[model samples]
Target: MAGPGVSRRRMLGWMAAAGAAGVTGASVVGTRLATAVPAAEVVTRQEIRTLTPDQRTRFFNAVKTLHDNNAANNQYNRFVLTHYNFRSQGHGVAAFLPWHRKFLRLFEAALQRIDPTVVLPYWDWTLDSQRPERSEVLSSAYFGGNGTGSNRCVTNGAFAGWQVRYPNLHCLQRQYSGGSTIGSWYSPGMIENVLNTNRQSYDQFRRAIEGSPHASVHVNIGGDMSQMYSPNDPLDWVNHAFVDLLWAEWQARNPNLANTYNGGGAASSNILAPFGVTVASTLDTRALGYTYPRWSGSSRPA
Candidate 1:
């Protein structure tokens, strides 16, 4: 892993070299060089399409391994339940950011347990707003295509014919709004406006981002993605990662309000359950030991 000072071009070069050398199975120690990128400090979450083919394969393989390992028990069931069970407290409130941060962290930890090389990559939906169907992230080589048939079951992508055993017994499903087509995605301009909010509190910023592109993406995805069990579709994690990235960016930009908390009124602080993390704990990416590829004020695409 490169140091925090390493250039983005260098980082991509390293990843490309790893992929070209067929070092997907290489140990973490083998990937690091002397006096440069630290052995234990190589963690980075990137845009999904930015990942090399090998990296993508490793990611999907780990997810599939966990899925098959807990076939009868259903690994995704617990996560989906956790979200729905706390729906009232988690969404449209101050807990929304902290709760999702913890949720994604846990899921990312589970992925790392299976494949140490896999860091959770996010899907920047804004980039796909112009022509979503043409986006490589949704290609057959990746997440597959839109759903078909009565149940709107997804029959393509890496997770084709996948079974989701949460809430009910069923095949993994998706119902694209326009037959085999996807709707217009959230624009980068909208995200820029949301992030540029001069709000004095976390909820003010949270409500703006959540109201537009955030909720818009969920509803646009439809089917399982529109429900509590949205995790059934792997895209849910990727989407949430982007959302969390935005929140983190908002925090970084407004240092004065970074520690501000108004969660659950005076009775309760900004404490998020399960992980028991406060909103402040979720503010710094370094404190969480991970960073997005483009977080440090370069979040907007030029």
Candidate 2:
């Protein structure tokens, strides 16, 4: 449930009361309370298309390594299970953005463990809204094309033969909504409308983005991407990186409302579940050690 009606004043009041109670942790509201990261330490997440040849090779190799590590605590399967088990807490709620922000951070950290130089790259589907199948991000050279055969198993690209462990052992799969092609996605104009229209409230903005472009991408991609275990698909990471970037862009545009969080019967101090940190802590991307590239004058990133 989402509380789009929660006002800015009420949200601020909740933060004030939390501070007065002497709440001291990453969950505390207010940007000033967030632990500051050194500028040199902060890394920028770039668009998937911008990654160089070597960068692409390293990233794909690192991800494949994680997938191949099938030990007792396999890091890759752990993420997919986490998302599958706690799917409800992260979606259709005000904490959607914050929950996924931390989710992406943890996933990125796992990748870094394999290759220190690798960072998560976002897939700006807006660039391929009209013909998603043609996007380089989904080419055989990258994430791979649509699933083939009756099982729809992906047989090309970085994760072509990946057989996910959670639930059951099955080859990674994808089914485009439009036969061989995925139908149109949310355009830049559509995302800009979401950003412009929901400036005053956190829940409003969260719902706008989540219900529109966010859901569209998942539904349009189909197959594992449309399921709770969607993280099984590597594209889930880059897709969410872009979603998280949109939330960051919204936060940047509303400096005064940076800490404004409420709705879905959630308090700012409420934990994001699984991730020990509170929702408040996940609000600041820089504090988490990464941010998207600078935004151009247009809604798309530079």
Native-referenced Cα lDDT, model 1: 0.67
**Once all C-alphas are superposed, what RMSD does model 1 give against the true structure?**
13.4
Question: What TM-score, to 2 decimals, does candidate 2 have?
Answer: 0.83
TM-score per model over all chains: 0.80, 0.83
Task: Please provide, for model 1 over 197-277, each residue's C-alpha lDDT reduced to its tens digit, 9 standing for 90 to 100.
Answer: 646788788766655466656555667776656777888888899998888778778888776666755313556655555
Error of 2 at 221 (Å): 1.3
RMSD of each: 13.4, 9.5
Clashing pairs for model 2 are none
Identify the runs in model 2 with alpha carbons over 4 angstroms from their true place: 1-40, 70-73, 264-268, 296-302
